[model samples]
Target: MARVGRYDSRTIDKIYTHVTKKMDDNILDLLDNL
Candidate 1:
């Protein structure tokens, strides 16, 4: 159970980072367009 939890946490962290980066990229694109 601990291992599973650790894996889940890592996966979630990576996903969060990826999402934030994508969001940042999107914002930059919008700013450029504007």
Candidate 2:
């Protein structure tokens, strides 16, 4: 059970990182457009 919980948290961290990176890209694109 502990292993499963650790795996889940790791997965969530990866997803969070991906989402933040995408957001940063979008912000940069918007700034370039202006």
Candidate 3:
């Protein structure tokens, strides 16, 4: 397997965590409105 520069696992995990956190916050807001 070839190392593809700076696009590593840690960066991917950070992005995934950030995205999931945003989604969770949105869901909570929607639920609160109901």
Q: Model 1, 1-34: lDDT tens per residue? A: 3655647776878888999999999999999999
Instruction: Summarize candidate 2's per-residue lDDT along 1-34 as a digit string, tens digits.
Output: 3655647776888888999999999999999999
> Of 2 and 3, which scores higher on TM-score?
3
Candidate 1 worst ten-residue window by lDDT: 1-10
**Model 3 over residues 1-34: C-alpha lDDT tens digits?**
1365677888878888999999999999999999
lDDT of each: 0.86, 0.86, 0.87
- Once fitted onto the true fold, the runs of candidate 3 whose alpha carbons sit more than 4 angstroms away are 1-6
Clash counts per candidate, in order, are: 0, 0, 0
Q: Is candidate 1 or candidate 3 better by TM-score?
A: 3
Q: Record all residue pairs in model 1 with backbone atoms less than 3 Å apart, i.e. clashing.
A: none
RMSD of every candidate to native, in Å, equals: 3.8, 4.0, 2.8
TM-score of each: 0.70, 0.72, 0.80
Q: Which segments of model 2 are wrong by more than 4 Å?
A: 1-7
The Cα RMSD in angstroms, rounded to one decimal, for candidate 3 relative to the true structure is 2.8
